[model samples]
Target: MTETITRTTGSADVRGLSRWTAAVILPIGPAAVALLRYFLPYDTVDDSSTMTSKVMAEPGRMSLVLWLGFIALLTLVPAAYSVGRMTRRRAPLLTAIAMFLVVPGYLALPWLAGTDQLLWSGTEAGLDANTITRLAETPHPTVAVAGVFFVLGHVLGTILLGMAMWRSKVVARWAAVAVIVSQPIHFVAAVIIPNHTLDLIGWGLQAVGFAVVGWAILRLRNDDWDLPAVA
Candidate 1:
């Protein structure tokens, strides 16, 4: 008879992917937020504007690109690893579905922001223009173009995220709920109000999401405990 092995390998694998996702993906939102907030200001077109398209263009675009890339990569990563970790345990396909949704949602962020960025690129000042100039020059982004994703992705994604975290308890349950609630707030603003309305709320909510996930990854880093082997 062959010796059978039942270890936390499945959990371990998902855990690894989760850690990787947390390290790379979680930081993306905050990184973009920080970069824009600190370096790029609100895009002034004044001659006094020091930053140029060449400067902010690369960093800003790269942030969106990399963030989306990570999100896409993670969609495949988590779904594959989750099938095994969650098999016969709980969540079943929901785990994979939730994991996969992250990609589309991420892609949506750049798509929505693309118009503004492209237009800004045409000018000497990309993201360093004065608020009034930027508002007057740029078209007030369309509904279908950028609004939908901003509403659905963040809102639904947050709900699924809360469920995922709650189901797995990878991070504390309440922390997941905290992230979940922000989605509606983001979605409502995107759907009805102006984008600027969500500036602080969106950033603050995302900050919480990152903090919780990052903390979970750090705690699990040294863990090698196997679920099956425990008993």
Candidate 2:
């Protein structure tokens, strides 16, 4: 009986730790990604050749930015999962749908990162900007599909998740609204206007939104965060 109790306690402890860790990293991922966008060395023109030239000009800084983005992508997975878990009880279907979109969307990071890596390699090989741009622009069917998934998944999924959180009342209404509006603003700032400052603000809203969620999670009892193991 003692052994059984100990085993159950250990399981509960592990579960609690997992949820707490997720809570801690939730805000961090979005914040890091937001900073990555703000500090990106690429030009605002959306021209591959211009971007390549800028990256080549500051290879070290660009590399660091890329790595920061990679790490942010890694962290976002758990952050999404934790949000889903928090809102699931009240909005199970929405959480499910959001996770379905978000998981693949964030997972497609490698496909996006491949372009940056390709540019870096071309620069290192002393290729001309136009040549590198040509290679980067060469479309692959698989990459094209992944790009679609990445865009739809992150943008739509985040909005859905925010709606779920709002319905569930897991986070403050303002925070939920922030999450819902963040991606659309980011899209406009990144694509429509291409203003890095606006881009930062867009993603910064998401970071703030998630930060509030993290605080809510931190306030929960371990049993509430993750159910205690049955004995």
Candidate 3:
């Protein structure tokens, strides 16, 4: 009977992880690809396309992608809290809230991506003189919406991630601190530099988060935190 229980629990762990992989981890890479398309180093920002005008042109659905991509970060930091909790006695509510935020945010991501395609297509095709002026006259409403949400999700997520570090102590206290501190470092940069390097940060951070989350999850699997099955 003990052996049977162990086997059953093991099976459950595998299943739970599989679901997590689909819902959270798997989407990170693809979503990043979708987001970086417009923001990368050499990405086109037409001389003709002013800050406001450029954003207004297409605005079809890229925000969805960016949002989803940002959602990965949202999921990532909380995931750290979850990891830290593995070794801690106190439960981490921040991580749980972060996890819960993932679904709605992710669901909204693809639509934003679509909007991007539409907006870009308009820009690449070139707008009429009047259209260009209109684009620049005031901030495009959609751009503001996307930008605010993107920043909010990420900045908050990083804080949550840092807190997880404080809680988990897995990557060592200093390293965890660095992870959390990186957010503020980058944020300061946004003000100092020509623009936010959020895309770059997103790309770079994804690889790191992937490795960290994978390691933590592996450890969880070994320990059978949920006690799914005995291995």
Q: Give lDDT per model, in order.
A: 0.48, 0.85, 0.47
How well is each residue in 109-216 modelled by candidate 3, as lDDT tens digits?
A: 444454444445445566564564454444447654655554555556555655665675554555456446554554554443434365345334433543454455
Off by over 4 Å in 3: 1-49, 52-91, 97-115, 124-126, 129-147, 195-210, 222-231
- Among residues 3 or more apart in sequence or in different chains, the pairs in candidate 1 whose N, CA or C atoms overlap within 3 Å are 43-127, 43-128, 43-129, 43-130, 44-128, 44-129, 44-130, 45-129, 45-130
Best-to-worst ranking by TM-score: 2, 3, 1
Candidate 3's displacement at residue 119, Å, is 3.5
Task: Give the least accurate 10-residue stretch of model 2, judged by summed lDDT.
Answer: 3-12
**Cα RMSD, each candidate:** 8.5, 3.2, 6.9
Which run of 10 residues does model 1 get worst, by summed lDDT?
79-88
lDDT of 1 at 163: 72
User: What global local distance difference test value does model 2 have?
Assistant: 0.85
User: Higher TM-score: candidate 1 or 3?
Assistant: 3
lDDT tens digits, residues 21-139, model 1?
55455545633543333333333232323333333435555355444444443442333232224221355455556555544555565554554344345453434445524443454
CA deviation > 4 Å runs, candidate 1: 1-21, 30-90, 125-151, 195-198, 221-231
lDDT of 3: 0.47
Best model number under TM-score: 2
The residue-by-residue lDDT of candidate 2 on 127-186, one tens digit each, is 998999999889577788888898999899999999998999998899999999988988
